[model samples]
Target chain A: MILQGADALIECLKQEGVEVVFGYPGGAVLTLYDALYNSQFPHVLTKHEQGAVHAADGYARVTGKVGVCIATSGPGATNLITGIATAYMDSVPLVAITGQVGVSLIGKDSFQEADICGITTPISKHNYLVKRAQDLPRVIKEAFYIARTGRPGPVVIDIAKDVFAATMDYEYPTEVSLRGYKPLFAGDEEVLRVCLEELRQAKKPLLFVGGGATISNMAPEIRKFVNATGIPVISSLMGLGVVPGDSSEHLGMVGMHGTYAANMATVECDLLLGVGVRFDDRVTGSVEHFAANAKILHFDIDPAEINKNVCATIKVVGDLAWSLPLFNKLVKDFAPDIKEQTASWREQTAIWKQDKPMTYKSREGVIMPQQVIAKLNELAEDAIVVTDVGQHQMWTAQFFNFRQARAFVTSGGLGTMGYGLPAAIGAQIGLPDKKVIVFCGDGGIMMNCQELATAADNGFPVKVIVMNNQVLGMVSQWQRLFYGERYSHTSLKGRTDYVKLAEAMGVTGFKAEHPGELEDILKKALATSGPVLVEVALPSDEDVMPMVPPGGCLDKMILGEC
Target chain B: MKYTLAVLVENRPGVLTHISGLISRRAFNIESIAAGHSEEVDTTRITIDVEVDDELELEQVVHQLSKLVDVIKIVNLTRVDHIERELALIKVKASKVNRSDLVDIVEIFRAKIVDVNRETMVVELTGEASKIDALCEVLVDFGIIEIVRTGKIALSRGPIAAKEM
Candidate 1:
């Protein structure tokens, strides 16, 4: 059938089962927007292009679908850069569509004409600039395919203004054939056998999981493997929710601010099985000292990640979905005495957990950030929680007891600020029945505070909790500890009444300053029907504990105030 | 250590920029790069020479380059038996008293005089990078005025294509 390029784009999106798109219209995208005017497809107009992309990111992270966003050229495309990078770093599937000036004006530096494909090349998994209308359908198909395939990341497609009005014979390809792009799904039998042999021989075996477990939807398989092998599991920040936080086999998150038991287990384990983890710097404090005694076995889908940071004793390059179940079967069939082999190691880790439980000082007037997170966790036990980067992010990771995969979403790799509010909006929109909450710091909340309007306009009942500390908590802590308290530009001055700001955006707001009034205010805000913001004033000097100093060994952690 | 890598990539706009941007972003300096169309219809082969201090640096560069979607395959030619060639054009200061001397040096190197003038003569030579460097050193006696050279381009001395690797 003959169709305009804009119509073909809409048809292709519908074919891909895309129900919603987050975007903001501009001059360059006028033709596309006009096509979307009376269409049944839902297009959410976010306040900013950044919010749109982040919203799409949140949607993708939760739904396991390719989140879609659109914006005009130039600044509109540039604004999506950080959000795209955030998705890229975290391996979220996203497709960003941008409108360009006419083909003739592209290199002329015409108004609103930016080389978006060039600008986003380094960040996106792949990008395209469609010069002919006939290529639009194929480009769209390729973009979605690339975005959602193995080791998923964002892909950008820029369309010229003239192409939107041009006509084409629409045909969306069902399969893509790229010589350079093939993902390995099955593990080598020899490699798996070698890994299983190592597992049987080792006494102190530890299972380390990361975001790939969740991305590949292998949480159930991992849980089964841990149960069958009786191996203790430690997770990276992005690996939370794969194994229930309360499970006996699960050690808390392992990293710079990880739990005492988790860090110690990493240092002392003799055989470490890393599934879907990159061994990022934060998780491995000092690569030389990280699991020095362990014979590491790594299973990951991306071959590039293999031996990039830490060398693997037995490397299996394949999808976790295939590898985890196979490993579980192998262990079940063999290694009958695996439970007996690791009994003493488990007993030792239990002692560590008991001796060094996470704690903080309790005071009368000042509300502790940890306590607030704990209270929120109690109230919203099954809610989808998103966080911005800061001390608050760490506190949430420390306190939130996630029970399901994809329950906790944050900017893990990029650690972008201003991620919480928009991401929460996306989650709430995508999963309307599930409760959504944003835990953001004072510094992060102010970065994209305008997203409150997006929530109110959509009538999304997302709860926003601001841990107002009046300072950049993480940087200030670093300065105080490393730079002799020479705090430069860390302290934030002036104040904006968050409750009034929430009210101004047509949402309910509540404030709690004292520990005594915190619970009541939180309950009230959580019970509100529409979007609500709860600003809890916290002590500015609070710090995230159990921090491994940068480049220091995992064994040398600063437990708390000296 | 100096390493030469032959990389096969999809022929598309902005791919070169992507490759160069990644190299610069990782702080890996490219000593020389030569790229052109390949036998395949929609593929281009780029030969890059990079200097690294250790094996880890080389491994990292390979890993990062492989992550790029456009990059199809990469092969390190340094470890294999490969034939390498570089082309050079040298314009030496020539006069009646020394023009014969320059001709003798050019004949010894089996080079052709592409252009000649009253004061300068342009000699074109193709050989291994080392040979080109050697000839340039000898021609300096005639007061070499200008020189242009292509970066090293290498091919494995076998039927196996770098892409097959």
Candidate 2:
């Protein structure tokens, strides 16, 4: 139907099955915002543009769909850069729509004009600057498609003010033709065979699957591959939940802050099969010595990432869904070459796992961080776990048995401190049916603690568990290790009572200092409907274990017992 | 190993700054850096050779180089199969007796005489990094005064170009 550009946009979003959008209004997008005022779709008004984009990111992480965020041009559009970069780095699907300066004022550097397209080119997967109102419907459809497909990432569409106001006929196309955008989603047969052959011939083979495997729904295939070969699996931080955490062969996470056995396997394995992992610097510390002697077979959906990081002897460019199955079939075909005794390998891994087991007996009076996470995992009712960066993030990663991909969302690459509360709000907005839990440390939570108001104001109910160590615990841990027992600038002193803060934000708040109180408060927090916060205070000296010293090799990990 | 690297990069905004920033961030030493337009106008080729510890580090250097947005292509042409070449001009004390011998040395190395005067001769040599070093070493006997050597610029063997994708 022929309609005003703003109304057409609203109709297009409705047609695309969008129920919620995270945004903040400004002058450039006033018409669009006004159109949304009476619309059936619910729009979340984030306090800041950064908050809006992050909320959209959280939504994307939970829903596995293209999250939509809107903002006006100039300062509003520029403010989305950090959020866009974060989403881009983590491969979160986001469609960001910005109201540009009027088409007539474009290139004149109008008061509200900023070339968001040019600015975000490097960070975004793809972006468009719509000069005409007629292009709005197709552009949004394309933006959503590009953002959600392939290696999911942020895509921006900047519509000029005039474009948002002019009359246009809206017809959302069923498909988009992007000349510069085509993602590879099927594996090459010959390469798959070579990888399989290599995997079969190796004495010890390990599969390192990342978030891509989960995004592409290749978990079943990964399980199949593991079952067929009995190969052990390790995951990157973002790659958690790709494999069932409770699996016997799961070697846990691998990287700077990963499990000892996982890092050891990466270093010493004869053949390392990487699926959907980018080999980030945190994952491959001292890249020169990383897998120095191993033959690597890397399979990824993105062509640009093929040789961008780790060297691959056999590179497969395809989606995980297609590549994993092809690999499974190829391994079956090459069963004759398969001969490797990994019993000894498994024994060594088991020995290390037993030597430095992750455990903590709750003290009679003090509520430990480990106990909180363990209890949360137990009573989560299979909730989505979102974490803020710090010691709490590490503890959550270590303790939670995440069974599904996208079940756990954390700042994997950037490790942004204030990511939790806003992200949880977004997650709740996206998955209204599921319980979204924000696990954050005191220091990290305070970074974006202001977002509690946004959550309560929007009525997006999320269970927030603040691990109150009362210091920048991760940094303090580092200082304790590297410095001369000096603690500086890590402690949060005289901060407002968090329970009072929650109350001020109109959400129920609870505090627990003992293990008994911890379980009871968590159960109560889980039972409450709206936004909630449960503070569990642990000792100041608590530390995350199985830690490798800075610049130290994988096998040189400081075992807790040792 | 002290290796020379030549990077053929896309001539675009912020390319050099991006490369330099990465070098600074990674703490990889840049012994020498020279950037200029190549045979193609829109393509800027940078020749940088860093003295580092191991071959694995060299691979990592190349990988990091590839991550830069403006860096269209990166080739570790030093250790791998490639044509390595460097231009060096040496102004040595060409005496009455050893003048002809210096000329012979220059001729032997296929060095060109770009400039010559009564008491000074500027010999320009283009060859592999080792070959240039050897030429410089040979000139030291004749009392080397001034030396300017371009860091090694290299291209892979035969018809293969560095894959930009």
Top-TM-score candidate index: 1
lDDT of 1 by residue, A1-562 (tens): 9999888899999999998999999988988998998576799889999999999999999999999999998999999999999999999999999999999888998998888988888788989898899999888888898898889999999999889999998888888877777767886878888888899899899999999999999999988887777788999999999999888888789989999999999999999999889999999999999999999999999877878789888889888888878878788876558888899998888777778877777877789999999998999899999999989999998889999999998999999999999999998888999999999998998889899998998898999999998899999999989999998999975668988999999889999999899999999988899999999888888889989999889989999931
Once fitted onto the true fold, the runs of candidate 2 whose alpha carbons sit more than 4 angstroms away are A104-115, A333-340, A360-364, B1-165
TM-score, per-candidate, Cα-based: 0.97, 0.78
Q: Assess the local accuracy of residue A524 in candidate 1 as a C-alpha lDDT between 0 and 100.
A: 90
The per-prediction CA RMSD against the true structure, in angstroms, equals 1.6, 7.2
DockQ, candidate 2, comes to 0.06
Q: Candidate 2 residues A1-562, lDDT tens each?
A: 7888999889888877887899999999999998998675689888888888889999988888778999999999998988898898899999899999987898897998888977877677667788877888887888887788878889888888887789987777788765334555776788877776677678778889897887787888888777666777899988889888878778888877678778888888899899999888778877777887789888888765666667788888888878777677777754434524566776776676666656665566887787788898999838999999988898888889888888898888778888888888998887889999999888877877878889888788899998888888999998898897699888776566889888898878999877667777888999899999887778887887767776666666765632
**Model 2 chain A weakest 10-residue run by lDDT:** A333-342
Look at candidate 2 and tell me the lDDT of residue A484: 70
True contacts kept of 1: 0.54
CA error at residue B137 for candidate 2, angstroms: 26
